[model samples]
Target: MSKVWMRTRGWVRRARPLVSLALVLAVLAACAPGPGSERADIKIGVQGPITGQWALEGLGFRNAVALLADEVNAQGGPLGDGRSIVLVEGDDRGDADEARRVAERLIAEGVIAVVGAYNSDATAASAPLYDEAGIIQITPSSTATDLTQHGYSRFFRVCYLDDRQGLFVASLMATELHVKRAALVHDGSLYARGLADWTQRYLQEQGIEVVYFGAVTPGQRDFTPVIQALDESGAEAVYFTAYWREAGLLVRQMREMGVDDVRFLAGDAVNNPEFAQIAGAEAAAGSLISTFPLPRDLQSPEAVAFSSAYEARYGEAPQSIYTLMAADGFRLLVDAMKETGSVDPADLAAHLHAIQDYPGISGPIEGYDEKGDRIGAGHVVYVVTEEGDFELFKP
Candidate 1:
């Protein structure tokens, strides 16, 4: 054999064993489980506006869910099985059409559960999709009463229904404000219309006359016609059942239009920091908002801890009560998962329904009724201070 040929043969012979050993090691490594390999990731969907006029509330929902996810993961996940929670975010832009698309996307992504679609319209649109897909949905702020009437066993909300809020508003107007005549206005959205209708019913029950029950196109800036209507109606109080932006604009316009004698009351949707900014401190001051307890007003240990954590992470306190409610929804889901030890939609739903007096960051959740409506949920009226802060209404 040639000298070069012999050298090549020797080299091949020497490398053969090394190559075989490398192959064996690679096979062993491939077969063996690595760190976190035994644990699977649990996917949860966080759906909301995220980028529209209600982006503040949507962003709060996302942030609160993310924070809760981080905390749960740090604690060895929901079942303490080393499985980590993976959050999938779907932004519906606070529109029903977009919410339908988001719902499909989240279902396709294989999310076991969802928390959001902050607007009632969005929630109503996406709820059917979730139900059909066997996914659990928990809304933090969608308060339309009809949502629970759909017979969707997997759907629930951490917040009270619009009917409850409406009753509270009507009682506040009758007992505290002593208004004999009220004007009702809505933004033509599901939440706004539902709240307005219920409020009108309760107000009439209280022997208060509803002089004007009207709808305003959402996102409209000028309210000259509505202000004129309010003036003509001779309403002692104006109850606005809509979001903060519209309520703020309407209130500001009313004050500027010399409609000063009318008391401006808003629904839970108006409990936002930007309300005062939009309406101006002078106009927003003394305005009553019927809503769940504000985060600043909550004094429970769980609430205090959540608020501190949220502030520390976000560099500011929660701007809306919905933020805390969003956190509560996430916690409720996790608690159900931990208690049931299963991610199956049916198990989670059943466990949620069975939950009683569950301590939540917002308050004690006294379980869900057969319709998935939150039981023992209550509302309180808050007055806007001159500094644009929400304080409990003593009167």
Candidate 2:
């Protein structure tokens, strides 16, 4: 019995090694990519302030992207190679530090491209990470001029730069509005300061006197002191380079202080409906806003279809042009993917650089210049009607 037990133990040990080897082989076979195996979905990151102060804009962006993704997936996606596109949302909360963390998270999720970071500071903060990861980033609304100056090939923007917007506002004030004195107020944000600086430079070059150039701390509800100073400056026009919330509050405060004679003008950041809502219809009326073409303003068949589809899906019209701009960015990326027949970041970047006359929902994207800045980007001024609706300014 002892001899038989020893023989059985030796046999069992030898079979144990064979069984372990077989199990390892089976696991490898199951994990290996082959026929009948599921293919990984291509990931795209949508980073924005989904929960914080800029939630409206961020939600609009996410909704637009989601709508487009649904349409594409229904049609078999961009590749037509059996892999669907999956969107990963990263809520940066409009903060620079949070944007960096979001970027890292997106990179870890294996996103090949990113569609946002609405705030200029947030975009600037996260751009390096995307570039380092060889992920393509296309911002829909970040207009800070220095963003494209970073020499990051993978970074692109569908919107115009602050310089272009500044020049446009300066030209409008000098050539059309015929203003001699202008007061410049900014919220001290990176976007606001850069826009204020460029607007100041252009206004000075255009020979308009800058009566009062100052910075206002964001989130300060009472702008009484600034309104008083602005009224004392005797400026004909006031250009507020900041987001919609502060612009609305400032304008409302100005009207409350009986500073009605001064023209209130805001940059593209104030294009949201909340601007007028916060300022009240009477106070918001007649204010000028420099912005890209709004969704309601687009007349093209494609634009009309997009607007209808967006409204049908979301149950309301897109509030800001940034939403449409974000959709355009997604379209451009998909176009590049289709043109190259490859999801390789380098290939997509190259295709984007070479793209010409690509029709976008916003307008004709004349393609990116050497610095990835959109060429032939222009801005138009909109005037708030008595009903608090934006209309293209005729004069």
- Candidate 1 overall Cα lDDT vs. reference? 0.87
Tens digit per residue, CA lDDT, model 2, 30-129 = 6554322345566788999999899998998899888888888777878888667778889999999999999999997778899998999999999999
| Estimated TM-score for each candidate | 0.90, 0.92
Q: Estimate, for each residue in 273-360, the C-alpha lDDT of model 1 and write its tens digit.
A: 8899999999999899888888888999999999999999889988788899999999998998888888787999999988899999
For candidate 1, what is the TM-score? Answer: 0.90
Instruction: Name model 1 segments beyond 4 Å from true.
Output: 1-39
Candidate 1 residue-wise lDDT at 186? 94
lDDT of 1 at 292: 86
Could you list the CA RMSD of all candidates, in the order they appear? 9.9, 9.5
